[model samples]
Target: WVQKSLDVTFEEAVALRQAYLHRYGTTLGGLTAEHQVDVDDYLAFVHDIPIERYVRPNPRLAAMLSAIPLCKAVFTNATSEHAWRVLRALDVADRLEWVVGIREVDFNNKPRLEAYQRLLAFLHAQGPDCILVEDRVVNLRPGKRLGMTTVLVDATPEEEVDFAVGDVLEVGPLVARLLEAQND
Candidate 1:
């Protein structure tokens, strides 16, 4: 479905997808811009994953989120419906103020400067005041370039991160400590 939607041959799909990510930050974004693909149909087709099988309720995660004193929102390359499903599976739906998905930005995903700009505007936040926690170093690069505090989760080398953590559970305490240091 993705190859058909992107108008790429099966043999070329992988390379095409990679090139699209390199050029436009997301393959869907590239398809939307260059091929005029229908955003809704494409998203629905791509994100129809069996989320419940993978996601389990974690009370510790919920507790960690509650400990963070900042306004929280989810910025995802996936559709908002998918994000909602994942959050509900994790039992953290009520913790976020909003979920900004690729559909909201006309299929534009991370690593694009405009996408970040739109997200900051949506949150009524400045880049410096925001913290971006991502597992992919490529995704974190744009946020770091935009002056947001970038935390590389489960990543190696830690070359470009303001902080690195082996688990998402560490984020709340790290934020708290950073806040304390700022105040001091």
Candidate 2:
């Protein structure tokens, strides 16, 4: 798909995608800017993941999220529909209150200030009120800079977040601990 869309060989497509990532923070952003690709069409085509094959309904995760009273949302560069599909597949669609996608921020993606600014404004919440949970250190940087208590999922200890968890299941306990600490 990437090779055909970029009109290049597989190897070339990989390199081009990397270049775009470095230049635009996202291949979608670069494709839209340089190739004039339609955002909706490109996203739909690229993000058509077979969620069921890779992700089964996680009842444990659903239970954990339900136990937490925080206002949950998925802040992603992917389309809202894609996020929704993943959440539903995980049986946690009802857990999140919002799916902040690229369209929601007018295509300003993560690791960018405008994207976070726009999303926070939409939620009527400031950075301190948000606890950003992400796997990537780069994505968590902005969240930290904006005063969010970042949680790095499936990662080793890092400077980017306040908490680092080896698995998503640990997040519930971590959040509960944080709340307890705050009350203390």
Number of the top lDDT candidate = 2
| lDDT, each prediction | 0.85, 0.87
lDDT for each residue of candidate 2 in 1-184, tens digit (9 for 90 to 100): 6688768999988987898788778888778778867677788788887988898899999999998879999889998888999999999999989999999999998878888898898789999999999988888888788899999989898965788999989999989998998999
Task: Please provide, for model 1 over 1-184, each residue's C-alpha lDDT reduced to its tens digit, 9 standing for 90 to 100.
Answer: 6677656688788887887788877878678767867777877787888999989999999999988898888999888889999999999988888899876765558878788888888788899999898888888888888899998888664878899988999999999999999999
State residue 148's C-alpha deviation in candidate 2, in Å: 0.5
Q: Provide the clash count, candidate 2.
A: 0
How displaced is residue 49 in candidate 2, in Å? 3.5
Q: In candidate 1, which residue ranges exceed 4 Å CA deviation? A: 6-9
Off by over 4 Å in 2: none
**Clashes (N, CA, C under 3 Å) per candidate:** 0, 0
**Clashing residue pairs, backbone N/CA/C < 3 A, model 2:** none
Clashing pairs in 1: none
